[model samples]
Target: MHVTFPGRHGADPARAVDGVDLDIRPGEIVALVGESGCGKTTLARSLLGLVPPTAGRVTFGGKPLGYSSRALKAYRKRVQLVLQDPSGSLNPRHTVYDAVAEGLRIHGYGGDEQEAVAQALSRAGLRPPERFFLRYPHELSGGQRQRVVIAGALVLEPELIVADEPVASLDASVRGEILALLLRLRAELGLSALVVTHDLGLAWNIADRVAVMYLGRIVETGEVERVLTAPQHPYTRALLSVLPEAPGDPVVLTGEPPDPSRIPSGCRFHARCQILASGEAERAGVADACRGEDLPLLDGGGRAQVACHWARAVRT
Candidate 1:
């Protein structure tokens, strides 16, 4: 998928998701990681036809798909989304069984409702399926409710599932169980998943590959082991620095990112980048030499793609 913004404006008048190019292969788990507002969710939404790119194209099964009514409906059936909040995603009035069965009905699956619900419940770890069938969203605990949401998407048997921070709201103890269930579902169904999250550790645990985004574009993408262990982009380095480490770890970056609306010019991350532009006063200080340069997203060693002119220097 190639996504671009032609003078796009976000909630803050800056293009939240700038030009982004990515692909999710079947049976592969791709993790999109970044700070909030980096367009991780927006990229996911664009795939689902929720966010229309101003100047780009999305191809599924080697065919182009715009955000048209028919194409979107078809895309939706093959690509399901599991939201972050089960409470918000599920209809409060509907029972667990109803929520799970909704997808089957919409897709015109005229099979046994009872059997499908049981299977979905089992897959989502809500075993002893009878217990959850009659409960409403409000009646179930946070974890259980999230399971219900998963069951709804899994029941459809989609080729791809976009989980947008599916466990962000759950308790830490229950978070593991949910992640386990997701892995189990992928294994059993051979389904591909795009997990959107800011937690690099979580991505390390689950994703086959990782794509690091910043200021609406993917700055670094490669095999999970390569990118996380030895990040090419300076932005990726800063993100890794803040992660929990062993005792006596050194402090990393200094401050927060620049404002998105008034984004730093040339390289979006040059303002916060420590290695990319150290000597150039205009690039280093607030004078803004880095503001005018546009760096292409280039391929680097180890099959990793990076978007920084100084990537070679940083990598070496």
Candidate 2:
């Protein structure tokens, strides 16, 4: 899917999601990783048809997404969203059964509602299902609430789930459990998922592939092992450098990312890129390209793709 959003106010219309091209194959788990406000959520929301793209198109099974209510409703049945916060997502007054069954009701599923709800709850790891049907959101633990949220998505039996920070609100142990559950669901049901998260650890834990977003653009992408172990983009390297398991001096960035409305020319990351600032790019003879020419994501003819001229010149 390719997605872009218009800039707000009268500022320059820098795309919240620039000209990005990404794909999630069947049964694949692709993590969209970045710092906060890097437009990972916007890209994820576009997949769910929540935020329509100002430019570019999102296609499902080769068909372009439509804006009609009926078209959107049908599309939603196939693609579901699991929000960052279960507490904020779930209605306090609604019971577990109501929350899970709402999608079925909206889609007018004629199947047995009780059985459908039970199966969804079971699939989400809320074992036995019946025990939690009458319970409210406030009564459930953080993990359980997240499970309930997943169950709600499961009720639609979607082929793809766009999870925005699915485990960010849970305890450390619970985060693992929830991630494990997502993995199990993919294994059992062949479900494809687009997980939006800032945690590289989470990407390393569950994603089959990782796309590192920087200021609304994917700077680096590849198989999880390749991208995390040998990141090409300086932004990606800086991110991995901070991990406890990484062996080396940390590559701390010097400045904040530029505002979306006021994005820099050429490489969006050049302003804070240590490689360019340290003269490595100049020594490599790619400084002019890094500072003047827009670098599109270039496939390395291997497992990884990167969008920086310096990364291409130095690593390839």
Candidate 3:
């Protein structure tokens, strides 16, 4: 999907998605990673036709999307979203069974509602279905509530799922459970997923592909193994360095990423990048250089597309 700004409305005009294009194939999970305010959520929303793009189009199976009433209903059925907060999505008065069955009711699925709700709950890892059917949003714990949200999405039998920080608020112990559920769902249902998250760990654990965004622009994207092992963009490397690591192969990235609204000219990451230091290297460091030029997507092997002029050297 491509998104641009004519001018700033709620989002900063200077900070806008430019030529943002990526796709998830069937049964694959693509993780979107960036700092807060990098427009990860905006790009995700654009895929489902929730956010209208000012410059480009989004197509699924080669058909451009139209946000009209009919198109929206079709898109809603094909794509589902799971928000970070369970309480925000679930009604306090509705029981778990009602919440899970709500989609079937809306879509007019002529089947046993109870059986459908039971299957959704089972798919979401809420075992002994009866345990959760009667519970309210407030009655369930954070993990269970998040599972309910997942079950709600599953009940619709969507082809694609957009998960925005699915386990962010859950306790550390419970986080693994939620992640496992999502992985299991992807395997069992053959669903494509675009999960938006700020946590690099989450990406490493669950993503088949990774997209790194900075200042509302996608600076790097590649297979998870390649990008995580050898990042191309300075912004991506910086984010990775700060994350916790094992002792043997410690990699520390330097400097903070630039702010979105006040982005730097040429490359937004030049301001805080250690790779661009003048005295340290006549040319740019491993992944530096091209400061005054715009880097388009470049092939970096294994169906990986990265956007850094010096990414080749970085990968080596």
TM-scores, each model vs. reference: 0.88, 0.96, 0.89
Each prediction's RMSD to truth: 3.6, 1.8, 3.1
Q: 8-85 in candidate 1: lDDT tens per residue?
A: 453446566667778888888899999887878888988888877766777788898867787787788889999999
| Model 2 C-alpha lDDT per residue in residues 35-138, reported as the tens digit of each score | 99888888888878888888778889889999899999999999999999999999999999999999999999999999999999999999889999999999
State the TM-score for model 1.
Answer: 0.88
| Each candidate's clash count | 3, 0, 0
Model 1 RMSD in Å is 3.6
Q: Give the Å shift of residue 300 in candidate 2.
A: 13
lDDT of each: 0.81, 0.90, 0.80
Q: What residue runs in model 2 are displaced by over 4 Å at the alpha carbon?
A: 1-9, 298-302
- Please identify which of the two predictions, 1 or 3, would achieve the higher lDDT against the true structure: 1
Name the TM-score of candidate 2.
Answer: 0.96
- Return whichever of 1 and 2 wins on lDDT: 2
Residue pair clashes in candidate 3: none
What C-alpha lDDT, on a 0 to 100 scale, does residue 254 get in candidate 1?
56
Name the Cα RMSD for model 2.
1.8
lDDT of 3: 0.80
Model 1, residue pairs in steric clash: 265-291, 266-291, 282-289
